[model samples]
Structures are given as structure tokens and as C-alpha cells.
Target: MTTTRKPGERAGLTPEIVFAAARELLAEVGIEAMSMRGVAKRLGVAPNALYAHVVSKQDLVDHLLDDVLSAVDTQVATQDPSSALQALMVDTYDVLLLHAALLPAFLVRQGARGDNARRLGDGVKTHLESASVPAERVDQAVHVLIIHTIGFAAFASHPNIDSNGYEQPPAVLRRDFTVGLKWLIFGMLDC
Candidate 1:
């Protein structure tokens, strides 16, 4: 027998719950195959029930990106602008690594149009300005940093294995990212 929800009756459904279910669904099936019906199946609800909270699949994906990015720490830890910028980038990398499945979404969406994303961008600009990066070059610097961070995280998320299938250790991956970030930061600041 099929059960239907009455009008205006949520049955404990909320945007948060929907987002959680959608994220789980994405993790299982990946972005290309994730759909409203798939999310509804995961949540034990009708597909139309999801529309009550999420407008469409793209909307759900956008919101998921923002939700994942909200965990990034945008705070500057040191007075030295370069160090502070590196810290922020490392934090971003860590957060993205944790939600590695969503990294492709970032590539397709060109980053989220949400508060958290704006905050991160603003933090990057603030650090660059503090480091005396020329105003005209700040945007370019920001792009370079973002591209590096995201690209590195996406590449590192996969198993870095040898011909014998021996995967590289996690510490090596992190060290490589930080070292590269440090070099990139110094290069941007010196110019």
C-alpha cells in the first residue's frame, strides 16, 4: 500500500534532513547519478516531498556545496599575512578533503554562490591585500590559490598507489600540499 503525506504536513521533514539525505545519496551514487527520486528514496519520502524543501536537483547540489564549505575555517591565525593565508588554504583543503566526494561539484559549479563561499573569498582577498599584493593582481592571486587548493584536494583524495598497489601515507599527501601552498604563497607575495 502507498502512503501519502497530507497537505502542509511535514512528517518531521526539514531542509536540514533533506540536505543530509541528499549528501548521503551523493556519496553513494556520485553527482551524475544523484536525483531527487534517489534522495527521496534515501529519505523514505516521496520525490515531491523533497521539492517542498529543495526546489530541484541542482538547487540541492548548490545547497550541499555551501553546507560542506561552511566547515572551512576562514580565520587568520598569524599577524604575518603569508602564514595566515597558508593557514586558511590548509583549512580549506582539510575541509574539502573530508567531503571529497563533493569536490567535482565545486568544479562544475565554479564554487558556491553562498555566504560561506563569500566569506572564504573575502578572507583570501584580505590576506592578499595585507601581504601588499597589488590591487589589480589580487583577483588573479585568489584564482590561483583557489584552483591550486581545489585541484590538489581532488587529486589527493584518490589513492596514491604504486604499481604494486601500495598507497602513499596520508602524512605524505598533507606535507606535499602544505609545501606546495607555502611556495605558492611566497611567489604570490613577492610579486
Candidate 2:
């Protein structure tokens, strides 16, 4: 028996392929180079051809994040939020170490409609919900956790800021941030 392949599948073009290629581009050429035109050229496809797989540059970015974040794994994240968060934090920190160009790009927000921000936000929200954290405070808690994680990654990586100033290495900053994160969260639980 013979099996048929999807139009894009045969060409090795799928949302996953788009995201993976984009991520490699992000690491190699920075976020700006991950455009549809660039990605198409990287994949050796026409610019319009990428549309069927990704809607926009923003869509590609969000999908890239989803693909990367999913690597953190649902089972581990679901087991214990605070602990899970700690693991997630460390894992993302490592990713940042490898993909320094994305430190700032990953931090950008597209407002309430932004999917990448919501991805991290919703993960923290789930943790709070499971912990029985107060509904009124869930949003706030999630905000703090997400910001702290992203900040820790940013300050941790400490990417070159327009080649003007230099900051401490991510490992050093993370040393302090990791300790501080644990202390802060532990202190909050006393409430």
C-alpha cells in the first residue's frame, strides 16, 4: 500500500519546520533576520509560500516560543507549580544562554492579545490556580513570577546593550536572582 503526503509535508515545511528554522535563524542572525522573506530564503521557498504555514512575523515568533517552551514538558510543569516553576526557570535560563539574541525579543509584549506573553503568563496562572492562590492575587502572582523569570533570564544573560555598556554574566546575576526568587516565593507563602 502507498501513503499520500500533505503538500507541505513532502517539502519538509510545517509549522514545526517554520518554527525550528526560525529559531536557528534567531540564534544565528538575531530576531530581525527571522522574517518571512529570510525564513523562506533559508528554507529555499518563495516568500508567499510561507504564508500557508505561518500567518505573520509575529505569528512565527509566538510559534517559535511555543515550540521552545513546550520542550519544558507538560508533565513536569503540571506536577508541582512552584517546583515546576523552578525547573522551568532553570531550563529557560539555559535556553537563553544558547539564544542570547532573543532575550529582548522574547520580552516584547503585543498587549492582551499577545500569545507569547500569555504562554508564560498562563503557565504561572495554572500553578497559582492549582496551589489555591487567591483569585484576586493570581494575576499579580503570575505577573511577578513571569517577570522575575524573564528578568532573571535577561539580567542573567546580560546581552550587550547596543555595544555601549556591559553587564555581569548571566551566571552571576542568576546566582543572586535564583536565591532571591526562592526567598521571595517562600516569604509570600507565609501570608
Candidate 3:
């Protein structure tokens, strides 16, 4: 399905461009509705042209997610272990909320294949260990923190929640997230 590129249209076509377009499309239409053709159309390129950068739709999604995760600042890991972990959770929640449209896809594809995800996981595990969490429980603790952050972002961003008459204001949601995260951290430390 390859076609001759129109002058000036595909001149600057690159993986970065493709990824940015895909991310925008994902945010606008969601994972289920996003398509290579749609992204290509968004970029003013032929659908097959995207294959030069992304092998398939799944690859595009993976790249998009990795890009988003890479934006998270995990430097809080350098601070006191427990406080660092709490900070990381709060930061992660904010990042996920910023890309709330992608949370559902991210939660389902929990496999940490991307470099950013691996680095974030490593930081969390290291912090947990530094906090003196049992070696056997480090993995569980990390999973709990990650799942809780993603779950809250996903639930909060759902459209039907407002129509269902259970909507909480953003301030209240943030307060609840902080309270719940604190409790989770306390429980992990107590164990």
C-alpha cells in the first residue's frame, strides 16, 4: 500500500512525529478507537508510511505509552525511602491523570517492557528495600502502589461516573488519593 510521498508532506516524517500524532489521537478517541490510518491521516501521510517507524498498531501503542512513562520524574527516590516512595506515588498519580485517556490501556498492559517502566519499577523496589520492607514483600508493595495509582486515575477519569451521580470534585479526589496513599504506605511499613 506504499505510495509516492507528496512533496513537503512526508518530508519530515519521523518516529517522533508519528508517536506524537498517535498520542494525540489516543487522547482524542481512546485506545479502542485509535487506528494507524487515523494517525496517518492526522499526519497527512499514507497509512502504510507509518510502518517505516512503527511495525504495527500494537507497536505504536507501546511506543506511545513508553513515551508517556518516560516523562514521569522519579527523582524522589533519592530522598528518605518512605517519603520518597510516597512522593513517587503522588507524582505517578499526577502523571497518569495527565494522560488519563491512556490509563485503561496502560493498566491492562502491565508488563514492564519499556525502559521507563523498568526504571520506575527498579526505583520503587530499591526504595522499598531501603525502607526495610521484607525482601519477599518488595514486589507486592511495588505492585500495590502502582496498581493503586493507576486504578484511581482510571476510575476518576471515567465519563459515566459523573452521569451516574457519583462524581467527586477534583479537590476531593486529590484529597482522597493522598489519604489512601498514606494508608497504603503505612500498611506496607507495618508489615
Better of 2 and 3 by lDDT: 3
Report clashes for each candidate as comma-separated counts.
Answer: 0, 1, 0
Q: What is the alpha-carbon RMSD of candidate 1 to the true structure?
A: 4.3
lDDT of 2 by residue, 38-148 (tens): 888888877776777877988877776655555443345357667766665666566655665666676774222345445656766776677677788887776676667
Which residue ranges in model 2 land beyond 4 Å of their true spot? 1-12, 74-84, 110-123, 159-170
Q: How does each model score on lDDT?
A: 0.87, 0.66, 0.82
Location of the lowest summed lDDT over 10 successive residues in candidate 1? 3-12
Clashing pairs in 1: none
- Candidate 1: regions farther than 4 A off: 1-11, 162-166
Taking the tens digit of each residue's C-alpha lDDT, what string does model 3 give over 1-191? 98876432355688888888998898899889999999989988778888878788898888877777787778873667878888887887888888887886787777335788878889889888988999999999999998888888777676434555876787677788889998998898888
> Model 1 over residues 52-92: C-alpha lDDT tens digits?
77778999999999998899888876899998999999999
* Candidate number with greatest lDDT: 1
TM-score of predicted structure 1 = 0.89
Q: Candidate 3, overall lDDT? A: 0.82
Candidate 3: regions farther than 4 A off: 1-11, 159-166
